[model samples]
Target: MDKKSELRRDLVSGDWIVISESRSKRKHQFAKKEKRIIVPRSSCPFEDPQRSGNKLPILIYPEIGKWRVQVLENKYPAFKDVKGCAYIFKKGPYSVAEAVGHHDLVLTRDHNKRFDQLPLAEAELVFRAFKDRYEMHLNDPCVSYVSIFHNWGPKAGASIYHPHYQMIAIPVVPPDVEHSLDGSVRFFEKNKKCVHCVMIKEEIKEKNRIVFQNKNAVAFAPFVSKEPFELRIFPKKHIPYFEETSEAVLKDVIKALYFSLKKIAKNMKDPDLNFFIHTAPIKNKKKYHHYHWHIEVIPKTNIDAGFELSTGIEINTVDPDEAAKILKKN
Candidate 1:
């Protein structure tokens, strides 16, 4: 594309997104206008997890008599723990493998308390659960990567209204992760430095795109934001493994995360969003030492229209600097 239709390459994934200034709309116009579809508490499956036919929680943290947060196997999982090792077999010209892995849900007790609304202590507990589950799945011989993510509203792929997070351990590294790993490796080989760390330094120096930061963690609107108000949170120290992070550092990271989400809710008019952890793959820790683990929070501001779907190039209307300015407001 031409300069007016700027194609920015993602530093980690190396994917190009077209920022078409020609097709740009007002930043405020991207705010969500739809009403959230609230599922009743009585019919919510996560209200009483066991009574809803869910298997007993693998891990439960009880506060008094009631559970504060619990980790349980998903009732309907996308991937299941099969008997044997996951194998790649040929179906004529195509190759496929059995989806042999683990899918679990980390659920909070309160139905109405979103991550941004949760108390700081409770939010920290949620990350503690994430680290616990991530470490648990990393031990599996068949697993290559574990993905921890949360979907907020229906548009962001939340089928249930109860606030919950999901962890999926897969036998192979996903394409997006593969691309990111490749990009990081290439950058490290050429520059001998972590790309994300470099970005963090630059963002800190610039201070224009910073949303929030503490001693241990920083959150900012990425320079190459794929969507409007795309915020990324990173620990100041370059750690490739999320599970290895300490509770104090994790609390700092979650604090930045909560701050980002709260700002997004207020600035974007409560848009649906998806936040996920991007860390080094479980099987190749040494190879990804130069990589940095972080969380990317993407607000569902626009749907994939014809151009985006055809070219894999997202069109972000709002500038990252503008987004940061808006989010920084009280």
Candidate 2:
């Protein structure tokens, strides 16, 4: 079949979404649950990364046998090194470019243990690796933005059961990030304050939407949550770059992240979740001072229907205040 994928724009939000009718299946097809098959340790490729044909790790912690956390080149990368920076060209009326960038995996030692299951010290190491690699990728001239994200369970798009995170450095800033940056800039122009910082202050005062907090970090269900059980973790202080955050603050942020995930597992019954960092673009440092770096954790609670597909708006079944109350109890 010919590829029938096209990008459609939402006039209200100015966001673009792919509409691929060729990829769609019957309505009942999505409801059928496949049997959860666990791949054995013997067949798991991450067991011995080097032995399994992966290149030597770019960064490894502990500097000893049985690595705790390691960063390696992705065997099957969505983006790869190219001769020059990405160049845009017109094909018919649409613009296209090469997928030139860096893609790597952050692997942990344990196959069964997820991020929330790891000890606090071990969990902190993961974020350390993320920051280190993020800074490294930012140095490249081709990279405009670096995305650091984790996917848990099959529903959240984790193909391999082995616990791992991914970093993708792309030439173009993603549309979602662009929209968020635009909103922050607009808010700051009018109010002369960071949008996220304002939200943090209100959330602190309200106290109902807070899930967990410490001296440096706070996690809460967002006031304008797009999905059920959506949670965001932000640094109390204004920070534009995730790579430039202080070690002390990052540790506290990681603690809040761990606590939030633990609560979700207990209260939501181990729902598949995706967590990712959203910060300023790598290219511009000063322009996005109004932006605040943070992490968004979205559980795979509901799927989009026809109405949601046609329109850009989401229909969240749970309220952020009630979601926070449930999470706080856990």
Candidate 3:
């Protein structure tokens, strides 16, 4: 860190991360390894989900022989699907509650092809499965939020090399999401507009950090990026909830995502990455109408050490403008 280091705050979440020019690495240094680990298809659980000791799928497409995509209950779930609401109880000085919710895996038929590699129709089907499962959780009293995310490659926390996405219904809103929701509420109260919509407008005007854009959605590297190659995708219109989004708008968003990931793979040497959706909590839909829903893509280019772990502020090693410039190239 040096004088060139700048502490930039995120407009939507109000979190600060440092862009330290002194700590920046060369562009080539961030490229992924020449060979990514590949798990054998014969041993993949998703190849024959039922034979691998997984329960019956919660939902399946086509509902017949030779499934294209299916959603199954995670064999080992982080949250347990149990009856009754999660109630907090004190254990001496600490308070805890039951982790009652659903964790399911959405798997495509192809074991080798990742989500980004899917055909547009297939990719859209994955999202449709996400929407169906998400809506199923809406009636559960124990569920307060549903997180939809994908972890690509080993470094991005994909223990299984086969391509799959996860949908997790949780008893409470996560702290990071809580911070974002609270910040959105605060901004709307003060400015009388959606914070994310404002950022999207500014990004549209600036154009320097834009990676890809279509008529209804745009993808860009955030000015306050927390890591190298961090990108955010937002619908052009102000949409408060992911589940409520129309098919026409959602298709454009998926298209933008497809192009963005393709650019990253081509330009950044197929780096491992994690992407997750941020939306208003399922518990209070009306309360967060002022909030805008979007997706965040963070490539695993850097790791946290003592400083980042202690202070909770990330040291981004690449300038977002530079990142966008590289990704924007054909």
Candidate 4:
């Protein structure tokens, strides 16, 4: 079967991913690469953001009358303001589009106290800022999606010694979100049930994969362990958008997130990890009630090798069942 820009189902999860034959990556040989050195804290640009010529912050939080975290435009942004209509330039068959989106960093008062170590209230405050900024960007005509994510430790892509999260709002629906949205739409069309809500119900029944749960949210190891110790936290209700998430649900989510991350921190001896929010596109949210939002945490346990990279399939060294056992024990 051929799909021009249609949704295709996955035999494994019975989910769907958009495969636009007309607009897709043409297979090519791998390019040459080089190793690079990590920047030291002393020379890290974010350590002294102002001195490094970063733009004035759009938002700032203070503690002890000093800067805790500030939301500033990325100094060397992937996206920047351009002339009318965010233009795209082309080089041969390749297309280069202006990253005409917003990239902001959320810094906590501490360069150390990793998110899991922060006071629950402080963590909640960080989330409050996340929601605030997300809403701000949602109104921007240029943005289609806003991604809020945290990279902890070196393994998870944190180049600096400091703990911070990033929010990037862009004009396009990212590939991951594209796949998830398609999945939920197909599920809803077929079963008339939300995919995530169904998964949560099944998880509750199996009593496996569950890491934690409270009145409003649930945390569990995903059925598909793209990487070992991967976890997804979701609101019990079938909320289509993250910005619409209630304050009460946010509090419980933070608790569940804190507990789950703390457990992984203990289990992996503080491995680096990347955690991010996955939700429906901000603009088309009304068309996505079946798209329940969630956070997925993938620990950087193993490096992506040749096969994993070439095929786009991640191989986990440890199994989910075993990972759950170890995390739960910790």
Candidate 5:
């Protein structure tokens, strides 16, 4: 009989993902170098966002000449900022609420340079802009959570070739995030320790799955990785809030992410990827002290087919250990 596939449950989210090494005949088969779409700068909206009909930037770095990063209202916002808080009411048997929130874009100056290719200083500045905008939304009466994410390449949902990130402040905690928060709190209550910090300690000790690590942060292919080459970055210390992260710790986390992305591009054949920050909710901050904030980087290496769609379980073809080995190579 052939060896059976493993069902690995995520430590933090409690979601189960199938790890079937037999799905791919060879290691190289897992590398799907997604084609890069090059939109001419002349036609790119981000080149001159104001001229391209975007709202004036809400915030800009350097306050003076030659802005390096700018945050502007998303031209096509999924959530509109209405006059009042989104209130839940009954629509017969269903509950309904106004979709009231804010959506913004953080754009970098160079069209050609993606996050991995950005200079360390410029990349850090990008995150600083995110922090500034996140802080701005903290006072909003309608906002409950803020999402910060970057989609690179078309597969990763980057419609425009110009590199940009998105921040959406919404009225309620999203279901996926809620699951993670619930799971982490449950673990903390039971064990009296942060779940992510425990996982980080194990990964650091094991070293098999670690992709990159600096003085204050570590990036690794998660043991229960839901997708091929899936990686997570965490501050070595237990930090529950992204906006409150100290400058020294944030720089190390940024360095870990910067190095990991470069390795993914070099070793994994430049596949399109999405990276997002996961932190405690903006409201009731004290209730989530047990949570440990982190970044999840998922390369577009696998698509959810029928099994995944029907079962809500992702089938990851590549083993995370092997993925880490490949990415760890110089």
Candidate 6:
């Protein structure tokens, strides 16, 4: 086989990565992960959800009958249910804020339909709900960043057998996101281009890693993916804010995302995965014109162990080229 390698830049953090083909596994040795053991459908809490003792919906879409999607306060929440600003508590030299942000669970009608299994139309509706609830949380003056994500299996942190997504709005921007936004700003001041758009253009030109593309969006396993089967989806257009995107673009992006997830599931055999959107901050949308919004999907296959945690870096066990080969088959 020919020698292979790829140089990739982080859109938000402006970090360069090298995907070395020397680290790759052989094609015949590419093993598939087993699908997760789901909770029995009978014991599935989401089915006939009301009998399961879930609370009243905070925001309901249809406003009648069994809801497809319902926003509810998390029962055991990391962030307090009471809405309030972060309060600084002094503990010696260190200061910390009260975990006093909003935590909500967005539930869909399906008990068995994983996000990847959903029809594109249903998946788009889930994303629309995400944006809607994000705006609602921002109405509170304390909210700075909202995280929307899905956890597919136990290792990925999903406790229930039923399909659901989560959103947490915090008073402070997450540190990783902070570094990313700072990097984007720095890149803008220097090179004067959205880092994500630059990657998209290059990936489309190469077409080696691109798994799927629609009119408005494209999905690919990143050249420097931190995990085997990691995928990222970006709008072909330079979209600064997710909420600000037109309905047409949003729908297309969701389709691209849904299909990308499906391909991952089919090829990787239902590896537990998590995905979230990374975008500019709520305060300085104008200042982040150089930034672009995209989704990152990380499938949990390897444990971080000592090497990764100590080094503050990840080792991708399956080469991205192999990952793309697996993911592209669907």
TM-score of each: 0.95, 0.89, 0.97, 0.83, 0.97, 0.92
Off by over 4 Å in 3: 1-4
Q: Between which residue pairs do clashes occur in model 5?
A: none
lDDT (C-alpha, whole model) for all candidates: 0.88, 0.84, 0.90, 0.74, 0.91, 0.79
Model 1, span 1-330: residue lDDT tens = 432566788876777876665676766777788887788899999999999999999888863578999999998999997887799999999999999999999999999988999988899889988887787876688999999999999989998999999999999998877888889889999999999999999999999999999999999998888887899999999998888888788889999999889999898888899999999999866778988899999998778889888888888776688789999989
- lDDT (10s digit) by residue, model 2, range 1-330: 563445544321345554443544532232224444577889999999999999999999878877899999999999987788998999999999999998999999988787999988889989989988888877788999998999987989999989899999999999989988998887788888887898899999999999999999999997667676789999999999888899999999999999999988777766778999999999876888888999999988678998678877565555577678877874
lDDT of 4: 0.74
Residue-wise lDDT of candidate 4 within 203-294, one digit each (tens)?
88877788889999998876556666789899998888888889898888888899998987766666678999998898765988888888
lDDT of 3 by residue, 1-330 (tens): 343678999887777899887777677788886689788988898899999999999899868888888999999999998878889999999999988889999999998887778887899889899999999988887899999999999889999988899999998999989999999989999999999999999999999999999999999998899889999999999999999999999999999998899999988888899999999999976888887889999889888999999998999888899889988888
The alpha-carbon lDDT assigned to residue 12 of candidate 5 equals 81
Better of 3 and 4 by TM-score: 3
**TM-score, structure 2 vs. true:** 0.89
Q: Highest lDDT: give the candidate number.
A: 5
Model 5 ranges with Cα > 4 A deviation: 1-4
State how far residue 329 of model 6 sits from its true place (Å).
0.9
Better of 1 and 2 by lDDT: 1
Superposed model 1: Cα runs more than 4 Å off: 1-5
lDDT head-to-head 2 vs 6, winner:
2
Better of 4 and 5 by lDDT: 5
lDDT at residue 122 of model 2 (Cα atoms)? 89
Name every residue pair that clashes in candidate 4.
79-99
